[model samples]
Target: MLKKQVSSAIIIVLCLFLFPTIISANTNEQLELYSEAAILIDAQSGQVLYEKNSQEKLPPASITKIATAIYAIENGNLDDIVTVSENARNAEGTKVYLEAGEQVPLLKLVQGLLINSGNDAGVAIAEHLSGSVDEFVVDFNRYLEEVIGVENTHFTNPHGLYDPDHVTTAEDMAKITQYAMKNETFREIFSTKELPWDGETWDTTLINHHVMVRDGSYEGVTGGKNGFVTEAGFTLVTTANQENISLIAVTMKTMYDNQVYEDTTKLFNYGFQHYETDTIDMNSQFVDSEDNQYKTVENIYYTKKIGEIVEEDVTTSGKLVIKGEDGRKLVEKKLELVTNKEKEKQQIKNETIYQTDDNREQHLRIIIPISLIISFLIAAFFFKQTRKI
Candidate 1:
């Protein structure tokens, strides 16, 4: 059998030579952010690397538009023409100057809503997708709660404006951003630096408002969203990638706009610098001391700090549990019991795989179950970001 150990090693080495070194913070206290709450996690694995008051509910401001944009892309036709209404045309705060009765494509509105932070465009999208903002709210929250699995977020309007009930936690926002980043359409629009907008009442270039993303000052900064209101203070969500690992950072309720940026940067640095994600090949099978066989339903991923030792164990009930060297549960996955037909399929996939030499060393990385034991090395770097005053 031919093993993929060589190829995986090559990929790791190439990444080391490509990106510059990033310094990880020594402790959570080292990250000094003005935002009241913040969180950072591995985007692909959904592993939380660092968090501060992450679950505290607070106003998300325009960050709510991230939900709005992704929802529209999934539920509405991008090419559909939408008739703008008076409410949308008259939306306050930032806007694309949508005119009453003016026709616009749903895709264009989403672009304007995200790239330019157009409040009017968000209203237009809500009206077009669900008839009215009131109706949009009911379905919108359901999509977020049911589809995205965001528990602590409740968006009252398509455009995140000041509302006491329109709130989300930093953790929930990070999860939402993580889910949105998976969609190619959402990712393309989220990372867009600039776009040309031809509106009924206004014509201009829609520039991304995320300072670091638009200015290209931060490395690996792929996508971002900025939000603020008198009530919400300032909020932000940012995504970045380093090597094979991607990170999602969220900061909420900073006194200044720059502080939110600062908090997000700190989270990114901590995540990218300290953690790395490892994959569990779907073709790999596992066995326990009792000789029960199991396999993952699909490719699974988990993130861990550099040089941290972890353990992998398969239960009799077909569950995979990953723990730290100290026995703390880090990640849990449900495995599938090996059956006659399933073994044949897995055998076909693993035909070319052969175990290495007797002296081969295996490091317990994240949660991949490629062999009888899931073992691999993990390492990375992170930096703290401060919002510029």
Candidate 2:
């Protein structure tokens, strides 16, 4: 009775420990805001921390210039002099007042588009890169597909002037910005508080536009682009870092500027408050021996140390299972004796190989049937004994 009671107590304790981990792994909230779409992401892990209608397509306004700048920096010579064309000077909306035939370097034009939100700079950069604005849009769309991994985003022009068909989602914008941020030149240009061009320095007067950058909660408030139009309302993308925790917060079509900033601030705060970088040792014997069948599986060997930084509330716990191609569990691992410290150490030792289980394959040779002889002998002996009785 004592043994049974002790087993029941252990079972109850295991259930108590596992229930919260399961719940934390799936816990999330979908906030409703005036913005058409929004998303907060961990910059390092590319993990979506929070989202609100993030996939809804909407006008991206000047935010489109980010992709344009990336293309220019990658393809064009920054020192090359690009002569302003008739179309570039006549480009509608915010302009840097460049006259036709006026010569400017590729670098200045990119800075103009990013800093002053100049629509004319977008046209100039497009014309210089692809010989025409139309061609640039095609290239931009292709990059959006191939490099940015954005499905719903389309660019009609270098400047995000309102086109009925030109649209992108908050999630896509986050993804694009994340990609663009990888470029050293793009990051330098986007984050610049003051830029000098045409013998005049353009200071960013719109400091209050992105609250996270101005508020100083983050150590390196790198730089991000902001946008707004009658159709798009208000949009902003901001990147901030606190210690090793870097985050990107995007808001679109917010009813008020304060609302967007407030929402984004909340997201940044939530990430820092709940989430942390945890170093798990993946080489520990606990994780290696987690599945007793690891030794029995052919062609499968322990690989590398793997660690994941997750929310404090979310427990990093999973059961080891030998699964077939169809995802049916063939064997379950029983962790008879394992310590949390050993598990954590194993996670850090080799993280890459165990991060994904997709390549784990079952070998046919391991499934040979040889138990029939023993079963037959046991049955014959049992029958003879019964006859004697």
Pick the lDDT winner.
Answer: 1
For every model in order, what is the number of clashing pairs? 15, 20
Tens digits of lDDT, candidate 2, 1-389: 99999999999999999996765553344455567688887665466768888888899888888878887887889999999898998999887777888888899888888887889889999999898988988988998898778899998999898998889988988888888888899988878776545522333343333445445655567877778778887788888877656778888887676777677767777666555432223332334423321122222111111223222111224344443223433333332234455566678766756544323433323333335666788999999999999
Query: Candidate 2: which stretches are off by over 4 Å?
Result: 1-32, 199-220, 278-389
Error of 2 at 244 (Å): 2.6
TM-score of 2: 0.65
**Each prediction's Cα lDDT score?**
0.85, 0.71
Distance from true location, Cα of 4 in model 2, Å? 28
Report the number of the highest-TM-score candidate: 1
